[model samples]
Target: MKRIFKFIENNFFVIVILFVAITLLYPNIFSWVLGKVHGINIMNLLLSIILFGMGTTLKFENFTEVFKKPKEIGVGLIAQYMIMPLLALTLAYIFKLDTALTAGLILVGTVPGGTASDVITFLAKGDLALSVSLTAISTVISPLLTPLITVLLIGNHIHFNPIEMFISIVQIVLIPIILGLLVNYKFPDFTENLKDYLPAVSSIVICLIIGGVLGANINSIYTASWIILVVIILQYFIGVALGFVVGYLSGMKMKQITTVAIELGFQNSGLSTSLAKTHFPNYPIATVPGALYSVWQNLAGSILAYLFRKYLNKEE
Candidate 1:
């Protein structure tokens, strides 16, 4: 059982794609999670579970890692925020996406680097401390930055209230992370024991979120999928390319460059979907990009990790 769970955790990209395909083909199976009873989505609850699990992996030492090399962390955070969000806005206009799709893509851009990124960083032999620091700091500040960036990018294309969105992120993201951090901090021995299980649990939760999004918007996605798919893939590749260039220009080490590139390339798609669904319930299509992105980024990141491990890490 442990080995099976570890395999699922290690091969998360496969599990994610498989689950999303299931929901997209047979919406009824996972669509039930999308159904809101008294205005609460079981899907969002699943998202919280993932976020909390992410927190358990973190330690206060990870936060202190920021001070050890402030420049790399700064470069990573700047690259993280500037590269993806701007590209998302640009692609939204280039594709001439409608309001709902535009909003969804924008949300995808603005969220922080996810825990999957840390895993990819580890896999690629990148600077793991820098990756964890960036993920930690970006996630901590997301409640403020996410909504602010969303307002700047999406603007009038989507009806947005930063305050409402702020509260939603706080509830859906920040709180769960805090609780998980507390659990880890207060019960280090306990957290260590569960560390192996966390990846398996988180993989399942991410799939459920992906499944819910695909199931809910299966019809719209079938008809209108190509452009956003292009946009999401572009957003990732562009961020990665820009991350390498910027890291190189900034004189980051090869490992740091790979770390920055990976961090810039992936966003918190679960949080993006939760925000889209919670705040834009009327625009069901608004959650589509985040869902699709959730699938594509993992696949892309895994492939990237392999290439980086094979080629880039050899340089170090």
Candidate 2:
């Protein structure tokens, strides 16, 4: 049973793709997961659980890496915020996306790095400390930066309140993470015991979240897939490529380059989906890109990790 769970966690990108296929073919299968539970969204709750799990693995010392490796972390921070959002904005304009998708894509760009990036970085034999630090710093700051940037990018076109979005992020992203950190702080042994299993659990929940949204938006998938699919590949893969370029140009080492590339490529897409549901009530399609990205980025990152392990590692 433990081996089964470990396999699921390690091969989560495969699991995500399987669930997405099942959801797309039979939306009813996972459509049930998309509804409300006592007026709280199941998707939002599931996403919060994922964030909480992330918080558990983190320690306060993670932030201290910021000071210790300022140049690397600083470069990552600037590139994370600047590269993706600008790529998203440029893609949105080039594709002439609707307000819903424009907002969704930009949100995917603006939010923090994903915990999955740490796994990818590990697989690529990159600097895990730098990856974790980037994720931790970005997650801590996301409540402010995510909403502020989303509104800044899309406010003129969309009329959602940034304050409300900010509050929602704090509720959905920040609070759960803090609670998880507190639980880990207070009950270190318990969290340590669950560490191996949490990734698998989080993977399943993420699959469900993606499945549910895709299930719910079955109609939009056919139409949106045509354009958004192309945009997703471009934005995420280009982000990864350019991130590597950024690292090289910054004179970073090979391991640091791999970490930077992965961090920039993977976004905290679940947060983006939850925020879209809370704020873009009218544009249900806004949640689609996040769901799509939740799958595509992991798949891309995994494949990239393989290339790094195979080709790039030899160079080092």
Q: Each prediction's TM-score against the native?
A: 0.96, 0.96
Candidate 2 lDDT, tens digit per residue, 72-101? 999999999889998999999999998899
Look at candidate 1 and tell me the lDDT of residue 4. Answer: 84
Tens-place lDDT per residue, model 1, 158-249, is: 77689999987888788998899999999989989888798899888888888878887888998898888998899989988999999999
Off by over 4 Å in 2: none
> Which residue pairs in model 1 clash with each other?
none
Point to the candidate with the largest lDDT: 2
lDDT of 2 at 116: 93
Candidate 1 has an lDDT of: 0.87
